[model samples]
Target: MTTDLTAFAHSVFEAQPFSRFLAAELTDVGPDSAEIRVRNRPELQQQHGFLHGGVISYLADNALTFAGGLALGGDALTAEYKINYSRPAIGETAVARAFALTTTRRQAVCQCTVHMLGDGEERLVAVAQGTIVVAAKD
Candidate 1:
């Protein structure tokens, strides 16, 4: 990613208060892909002591949107998405990786996978697919 684009992505991310509260990091934003990482915290866990499903979903959603936005080369918003949780997220950190699967003039289809990283290994926790459309300009 170009330095300008990287700055733009970070600025957009920093504008989200919820993401900041979660301590999420926009680790990478590229032409066709994006990545997000969040450190595990007790407040983010559920009854079973695993990362809450909402947290996993948030990571996937943001990653997919970022990928689509990058593919579109401008602002974009998620149209809709579906996610499947394969396993509990149990790790020191969670990582979401997303890529644009297809793109048109105004929209892109994106896929995302969320993983739990711990002890030198990563385990799949969730998968998601979403459609993103260019944001309407003011």
Candidate 2:
């Protein structure tokens, strides 16, 4: 299959105004998966000196949305999503990986795992699952 998940991620990232604010980068993408990384900049830090939960959640959502788009091979929109935080993310970079778990004519189900990388180890920070609604092509 001629799946260009990376291209789809880049397009989605570029289309979102807030994505630029997050400074997220699409590091890896495949037929049914995508990964994103965001540096721990000063602006992204919270009061306790850890990355904010919103930032990580945004990254995770984007990754999952992109993965769903790749699976459907069409325009998609997030129907619903839920995220659970496991720990505070205190690291130099936050990484999110997402994959499509299932797909139907109108919806795609995706899962995303977010991790904080620091001290040479990656710690699970959050996880999310979402449904993306795909629209018919013109």
Candidate 3:
């Protein structure tokens, strides 16, 4: 079923203070997919002049979590996650695209890929996979 993914993303942003701190924007959200973007700011950079790994991982994780939530049509929490960094994120902005791979009554599995935007090359930065548990509204 189609869902209002933008509304759901906004609710998640409102509930997660750290997502606000990261300045993450939900660019795309559909029944089984979502995308988020974050501009590279000094605070998010490391001494090496590249985006910090943790920040990239966080964005990927959040994207996957949101995708899972969209797929489940309810609140969901990440039960496990894995990330692989492919390159340094040194661009002005990073974008992550997430999509659900599978879903059941209780869980959803999602994957996200992060890339540096600009140059139209869309070079890969990182990839992540997550399993999320659907939860009842509290």
Pairs of residues at least 3 apart in sequence or in different chains that clash in candidate 3? none
Models sorted by TM-score, best on top: 1, 3, 2
Pull out the clashing pairs in model 1. none
lDDT of each: 0.94, 0.86, 0.86
Model 3 lDDT per residue over 1-138, tens place: 444556766777667888788988888888877888999889999999899998899889888988898888877888999999998997888999999999998889999999988666678999999998887667
Among these predictions, the greatest TM-score belongs to 1
Residue-level lDDT of model 1, residues 7-123, one tens digit each, is: 877898999999999999999889989999999999999999999999999999999999999899878899999999999899999999999999999999999999999999999
lDDT for each residue of candidate 2 in 48-79, tens digit (9 for 90 to 100): 98899989889888888888887887577788
TM-score of each: 0.97, 0.90, 0.91
Which residue ranges in model 1 land beyond 4 Å of their true spot?
none
| Total clashes in model 3, counting residue pairs 3 or more apart in sequence or in different chains | 0
lDDT of 2 at 51: 95
Clashes counted in candidate 1 amount to 0
